[model samples]
Target: MECWVPLFEIFLNSPCPETQASLWLQQSFNQPGPTTISTSSFLSLLTKPTHITITDSSSPSHTKRVMWIQTLPNAVQARVLSFLHYDCRRFCESELCQLAETMLKEGEKLDFWVKRAAHQLLDVVSRSNYEWFSSLNLDSEEEQVENEFRSLPDWLKDDVDETDLMLPWLPISQKQFNLAMQFSSCGENDDPMIEFEEGKREIVEQVIEEVDEVIKEVDEFLNPQVEELVERLKDRLLSLQSTSKAVELAGEIRELCKGGSQSLAILGKIEPWRADDEITSVLVSNLLDGNEDELGWRSHILCSVILPKLLVLKEPASRVLLTATIEYCKIHQRAAEYALLLPLILRTEGINSPICNVLTRIVTESLHQGHVSAFCQKLLSNEDDLKKFICLPCHQSLIGSKLVWTDSLFNLMQNILNHNIHLTQDSIDRLVQHAWESADRFSKSLKFGNFLLCFVTKCAPMLKSQKSLLTEATQHTNTLVTKSVLSKLSTL
Candidate 1:
């Protein structure tokens, strides 16, 4: 009963190949052919599950040996015999024989006779009849249906006993029942009071049980005498056992202790197989393969716990964990915590992943809502992989933030302008334009007017030839920069 029988019950109850072959053999017995077995012979011989090899004397006919030669349950065997279109049902009837074979005089049947018959008949059959079920050449019509049924969880196949579940006869008197039926039958009107009373009583009973449990737990924890008695009993029990047995029993005690709600306090500790890579892979697989009912909770666990653990680890292991987080977000459509990890993941792993698009969307939305952390801002300023993925709002948030305008801003801007590598001139221009627009649109903004101009001004000698840089700078300049914003554009 404790072995998870429900999981295998459906499969066990399914039509065995032997059963199908039994049906086929019964049909063959009724056919007009030399290969068919006579009813008298089949009944007498089939009584023992010894294999029977039937061969066609006709030219080029293949012989089949039905080898299931063991006793099938009476019901199943009877059903198999009924497959014959003829009067095969007569074989299933008992008390038909005038002389019943009684074994009262003997201790048991002769083992010699049984063994001789079994070796010859079964050895001749060579294999089970069930193996030839495919020889009947069935269609693929039931293939998909069988596969889906096979994949179903065992609990779905288990039939709960409704005998225990059925409500007892109503406790009300016959007069009360008649009155209730009369009211219930009149225009078939529903009585809300009747339904409400039943539901209200169940809820009140449940609440009282929960309250009693809470009070008991409180009393147990607060009572010092109970704790002392438990400690004394534990010491006495250990004292009674030998040292080796005591140590052995200690493992069971530890395991029992690790199974309650209180055990979750150690989720951060090792021994949950934290050191094993195989364990992580298995945990991830189980999460992904969990039934639809568990998926929401699994996703919550992934985001709240798994993600923090992954972030602390080194990748490509972390990369695999990151993929799990994004794939979960991409499929489950609930990415609140995962979206928060996008920036840290982007900074650490970069954009070489299948879930980059999911990550991009997460980052854009997070940045737009100003949900990104300060560390993410520094990462965004440095990492170019996610730079192109950033939306206009994200770019605006980055530029207008106080973090971006620190002393490093001058060198960062200078390197960005001089590099002229991954980002195009037009893209850089648009970024500056959007930054100015975001600052102006928001009530409070950074004074990028001079800071940004300083970068261009610091590189004025180098940009004197590239007037496009001066023109772009001039376009982004505002009142915060009093000096000719772009010194190279002084004449222009």
Candidate 2:
């Protein structure tokens, strides 16, 4: 068997047609000495061929490999497949689908290894590529195909219980398992293997119990190490003097946090360092002073973990941190970075003078329209916030900005108008003038025309004195705007 591997590669890599080589390999698998080879060596032979195109199961080479696997003795066949299921290199979806079909056709002759291998392959293939399983057309009414199409879980019902084989392959966390269950069905009534006879209710309970036991074991094992690492992080946070050093330390802190709730619990117990004014200042300064590209990882830790925790400190400490953050946004013009701090700023500082300055700068100076749109959507959710945003000192600049004329912003403006929020007369005039300019500039645009129409209809009573503007709009060159204005002139 070991000697045959080199010869197999030589034959496969030769100039001969792949069909002839595949036929020779199939005959080689049937030879008495090679049939007695260990299961590991057999798996190596299957995977070792770099020339084997495993993706196309219908290809002659791939079909011949499938036939070779079937010709192996029952014990060797089952073991090879079972090992293949867990190997580092995975079979493609097409190959797995073919294997599943073969196992299902075995019927009464399906023994323990074959049944278990079939179940494993089906479970993996179904979860990873559900469309293939869904396309099996298992609902066919023909007697023979229907018999072979029986669900794998139903076939394995007598052989294995939930604890023996089912739990081992299930998602470890209850949340992941629940999400999988939600989308795992083939149809309304068709049972996939992920669904047990006990149904989701009981299966979920069992999963929770199993997950708790595993978590408890992990917590017991990791508690001491997490506590030690938390203390180490505290020392590094205090002693680090340079921005580059702090950035390096940030990577270690992020890794510690990835240990999940164990490290968090340990860090939570040691809250004195998180609240220290000196430490908070150092973190904020490093975050602001570090090079933008070098500080990417540290920014996430500071914003998500350090900044939020520091903001809960006393007035003097939190106020100083907020001022520094505002100045950083003003100088760097990093709109995306500033967004990470918005929720904290809104909660702790409200829409104050400093906040308004940064928001105005973002709207006018930032090139990323997506970040600008996100800031607007989040900050202007309610009527009062919307009114406050519209009344900014740079409100005119915002109106003429590129984002204000977009469809999404138009919808936002329409929402404000529908609520009947009162804007100062000057603000209303500037908004209407900007809309008219936009409509005239892009005269053929249906979207801008519709925006102008919405403003005219919704703000009709407020704009009664602006007859010249309405009359000008009536004779607009765009045919859509003219027809729409004519249709609604009586109401106006």
Candidate 3:
């Protein structure tokens, strides 16, 4: 252990890197060496990594240790590089990319050491940074800022689909048309005279026109299949009770359209059933009616089927669906904010409608327990209706129902109290009240007490044996819990 201390001291005290590295390398191979070099000095040796040499036949553990040391943070990487150089052949391509992406996401400053290491990697790839740079067009200062922060530019906000990048259906510009023609044409029948060449050009133009006609014909021939696919998409949309799928389907159709697909032609083929009404029905059914089966169907209809259908309408009652949704929730006493609206911001119809006013009134009036339970049962049964007629109300209703479930509230509180030390006063109060109420209600009926205890002692443990906080909390608060349990019991 004492063999290398004098050698390490001499290496550290040495001014020249070559001398220090020579001594360090000689001692690294020697067994029983205890060097008292500081972390900074050790790091300096690592950063100049060329000094250390291990054979390819070294044990896996030694290789891994060397690699791990090299991949450490800025100070560590620098020290390791001094000894090992910035070579990273041991890491997988995907793993390196992931690490880079993570570092970029974390807003870590690109220190000199990190940049040098990254540059060495760039050299290994031997590809021009410009080509990779072109793929991410963050040339502008604003774009550069957004990119550095791992965010997309405003221009890319709507470019949500991977397929959109591959599609070639966008209307062709005059320049693109010329370019396409230029690339398509190749001939050896050359005219010597300039005037004769004009004739050849005319002939080529005619041939290009013919090719364009053929392309158009091919597109026309494929229209039927595209139309069939669009119809299938429409059918799927209309059958869904949730609008979530509508946004996704919209993206899919957008890609199809961009791909020069003839799916848009099927919009004309839809039967004259009112789209707004159909969409309204879907929203109501999912949000109020609790029809999970029709959820996927409704999503397709709202954004994909309904919006496009509305665009085609001679007199589009676009607001009808939104109004109907709000009004239905009002009459049904459901909450007003729809969760689907979060994603479907572009498709939502109305900010102010009679249905919304009614929903507000219903939520305000039915905030109490007796009214809430009655309202919840009705809303749960007719979730689809609520979603169709009033999406916001459906969300509000669900949120309200979740809050109203005192047993769930108690458990949630107990969990926070036992597991989370950073509990806010409001959360603590809310949970305490919920637990107290649940305990009060349980203590009144012998059957309820047995059921509660049995569930905590048996079913829950079987399901998740590791956590017993809920059982413990309920037991600790048994007396106060029993008192509240009795009070609620008298009413039940």
Candidate 4:
């Protein structure tokens, strides 16, 4: 290191690159039996790199040195070139692209360094070069390598998968990684939605302003059509300007329609401003108007607004809506929609009401609709909704007690258990007690009561170890993690 300090200083301080490089070479290498060459000839020779002889002035005997650029080995030179700035690196590539294969081993490591250096010039490096680099069978023969290399774009192509630059949430398995790659490149909609909303708001404002301008232009004094129209049937229209009269009229109308949905819908259509409850009542009435054939013609606005409101309302009268909806569904075979809405209604109603009749109807419906599991689970979800519902006073003998028992209550209880919604051990005795009392009070047959008692006891608490959805999901996650670990271990 000490021997090179003075020589390094000469290289740094020297005005001419040729002299500095020449002196650098002299000190770096020394060999015997050297011949002299002129300064111009030596400089020309340096352009085409080759072994050369130079006299070492620092040696007292004028010892000779054979100097070349071999101080930098092939691997280290490639590494150094990799760190250069984009513009400088590009210039180096133009000059040295031919020498690249000769200097570095022909493999991915050398190819990767070249690609990496070029990548620094592009902001979206990860997006570029993925397909070309990945598709190449570098281990293949020269002909295949050449063919593959030729297939790659002259310029870098945009990446097909963005998983590489993102966090390594991609699993150990390649198939899973490919499947789970979050396809965010094209379907991004947040900005587009915001822009669309702004545009729509602007259009709406412009339309309102244009309408106001048109209204301003209409001279009320001269526009006889407006006056004549207003005069023709002013008696039929309800004027809301007179607050006291309008309110009294509304109250009277509300009283008249207080009976049911059909009346409420008529009341809503008569006056529609600031009337949410009346409007919803009209909507539900319309939705369940036994128009399964006319679903295509039904107003989406009415259906969309009323269904949720009806479901959220916990009134026993909601049963009317439920019963109507069920009849409509059965007639239309709308099992999909009925199945989804029924559960929502049941969850809202809870177990307090006399809902056993509703459950029995649904049970009958489920025979054809095929969503028995979902409906049963929902019924039992409300702190024993099914249990308490089955024991309601009004519902005890009111169900007509007339089923043929084709699908017996025992099998129904088993189905409920299969759905993983059973009661606790403590509730079993009480439920049995309630069933027997109801059976006796209603003067039902002993045989039927005995079957009911047997069904309830078996369904509650005995099968507590049955796998619920939560337990199944937990087990599934554990299995996935174990498989992933095993995959990684095998790879290692």
**Would you estimate the TM-scores of all the predictions?**
0.22, 0.26, 0.22, 0.21
Model 1's C-alpha root-mean-square deviation from the true structure amounts to 29.1
**Of the pair 3 and 4, which is ahead by TM-score?**
3
lDDT of 4 by residue, 201-315 (tens): 4533433353233223222242354334334323333334443444444444444333332332332233322334433333334433222211121222222333333333445
Winning candidate number (lDDT): 2
Taking the tens digit of each residue's C-alpha lDDT, what string does model 3 give over 83-148?
Answer: 222223433444444333333332445566555444434333332233445466556954665345
> What's the CA error at residue 14 for candidate 1, in Å?
60
Give me the displacement of residue 451 in model 2, in angstroms.
Answer: 22
TM-score for candidate 1: 0.22
Candidate whose TM-score is highest: 2
- Local accuracy by lDDT, each model: 0.35, 0.45, 0.36, 0.34
Where in model 2 is the C-alpha error above 4 Å? 1-222, 242-248, 258-306, 309-341, 355-367, 382-492
Better of 1 and 3 by lDDT: 3
Report how far off residue 435 is in candidate 2 (Å). 20
Off by over 4 Å in 3: 1-59, 63-234, 238-248, 252-390, 393-402, 414-421, 443-492
Ranked by TM-score, the better of candidates 1 and 4 is 1
Assess the local accuracy of residue 425 in candidate 4 as a C-alpha lDDT between 0 and 100: 46
lDDT comparing candidate 4 with the true structure: 0.34
lDDT of 3 at 383: 33
Superposed by TM-score, candidate 3 places the C-alpha of residue 224 at a distance from the truth, in angstroms, of 25
Candidate 4, position 51, lDDT: 50
Question: Model 1: per-residue lDDT, tens digit, 337-365?
Answer: 32234322433332222233334444332
